[model samples]
Target: MSDTALGKDRRFPFGLTIATLIAFAILIGLGAWQIKRLAWKQDLLARIEVLKTAPAQPLATALANAQGRDLTWTRVSVDCAPAQPATLPLVYGIRDGDIVWRATALCRATVGGYGAVLLDLGVVKALTGQSAPAPVALAAPARAVGVLMAPRQLGGDREATVQKFAAERPAPYILMVETATPVPPGVTPAPLPAEISNRHLEYALTWFGLAVTLLFIYAAMLWRKMRS
Candidate 1:
């Protein structure tokens, strides 16, 4: 009740503690989210590995089972007895550590989903500076074997751009050809990643470390305030 008693009474830093606690809670939540992401990434990589190495099956069979499942990088083969080819759009692709603009083509699948599928025929090599590579002649092959992939969405004017190359506007998918002989000359297949990145563990550790450091700072501040 006296002045000395009031001065001796220690008051909790309620505002500072609440703010620190909120920040700590957010950091912990982020770390937990990253952990969940880590598990998801691991599962995705495992599934991709299995699909890549699994025996090649009919394109129709793969397409049928692709519903509600990621069929990316799956090896598929089709007879494609009467394959028709048309150049899609010119896009830049990497080849042998060199950035080169490669021409992509579309092959109308007669057997599988009956949808037109895009094919990365090969790299366009220009001997003359600023000159474009000669277009590869399209040919119908007896059989086509490759990895099925989803089509990339164009940034602007999607419908017009897609329709220009893809007249049939087949299934929204493409196939990076692994082996389709007697179709085009001087065509090399584009490379795909063997494994996807899984960096969630590092991110989770960073968030957790931040939370721990915050806790230590908060504790030190409280101790100093109490002593004063």
Candidate 2:
């Protein structure tokens, strides 16, 4: 009820006590968030393990059976046998009204039947006056690993889109690879590139703990001042 109670808190004892409690709550929240992160990371690791161990299946079969589960964590690599050279209709990253570089790997099955992976190789920077990287020469049993991404129907000039042959480019049923590993004929496949963001859990704990800590400190001080 008095101006003294609402004044800018400058008293050493009170200020330090409040600040210390706030800092303690922050630290506690951080530690708890990290604990939750540990659980999430463990789950991701388990998913990766399953992808690697599960028997490789046809891309169609895999896509059809997926019951709304995140297919991005599900790694599938098909042995592609590209005969000569081909490109598939793909999404390109454009900047300043010019196509910067192709993000989608427009690829074709070399031999008869094999699945293609949308490889997310580093985008080609144009400032250096460079061109798109030459399509890698895929040898027999080419391997690729990434979560199976459902392809988008990018309806545009079928010819204007990136591809080696127009005949190969229909409404593409593409495989979206998260972190791609191209195991060309001779080389072996690499582990999935790990990328995990951890802000949600951090914020959750911070907000919840702040609410709790503020309530406690406010209650304690109210009781102290009243009793005094």
Candidate 3:
């Protein structure tokens, strides 16, 4: 036989080829998905930063804009009716790199269209046997400037939540007290972060790197099989 005879008639392993192709395609798809997520995360971060710096919007105007949308971090201000406090549950806050518990309360809106809105009076360190601080006493009408946020939703218990806040219309959102004009005594503003972490880039790289490793491994296996 000619020296090239050994090279001329070897058939590729069709099954192995197909399996390798499928695996490569799936890995590539995962990598591409991560890249798309990276872009989306960047855009979300930019939007959040802009929202943070834009001038504080009036409660009414902000409410109108936030309706039927995610209004989590929009800054808003309003001259509100005195906030009555209720000790329902403990909301957490961070201080000095440690998780700290703060007392949370509901601030019912007494103004125009925003009426019935529940503003979370800023958290405090003191709690009176109910994991919540004593009720905040506000003079009849008070002015509050803060970021609007959604109240914490409990998991899988829609009926329980409906029954819990029965007396309140609980606006589509809640206010995180940033500052009370005549600052409420003992309550500290729950400062919102200027920007949130965007880790999508790192995640994307990990997924892509894994895809590349898989490609190299498949290529090596094929080369070894063909040579042997």
Off by over 4 Å in 1: 1-11, 79-86, 93-102, 111-114, 122-142, 152-167
RMSD of 1: 5.0
Q: What residue pairs clash in candidate 1, if any at all? A: none
> Per-residue CA lDDT of candidate 3, range 91-142, in tens?
5555555454443445556433544555455545453234334444433126
C-alpha lDDT of residue 16 in model 3: 74
Per-residue accuracy of model 2 over 1-228 as CA lDDT, tens digit each = 456864534234576567767776776776677778768877867776787667556555555566555565555544444444334332344434555333344444432233333343333443222344444432222444445433333234323442443455322334433333342332222224334454656666666677677768876876665554
lDDT of 2 at 129: 28
Candidate number with the higher TM-score (2 or 3) = 3
Q: Compared with the true structure, what per-residue lDDT tens digits does model 1 show for residues 42-158?
A: 886776668667787877787777776766677887665464664455555444456665446555665345565556555556522234555444554556677766654322333
Candidate that beats the other on lDDT, 1 or 2, i.e. the better one? 1
TM-score attained by model 3: 0.69
**Selected candidate, larger lDDT, 1 vs 3:** 1
lDDT (CA) per prediction: 0.66, 0.47, 0.61
TM-score of 1: 0.71
Candidate 3 clashing pairs, residues 3+ apart or interchain: none
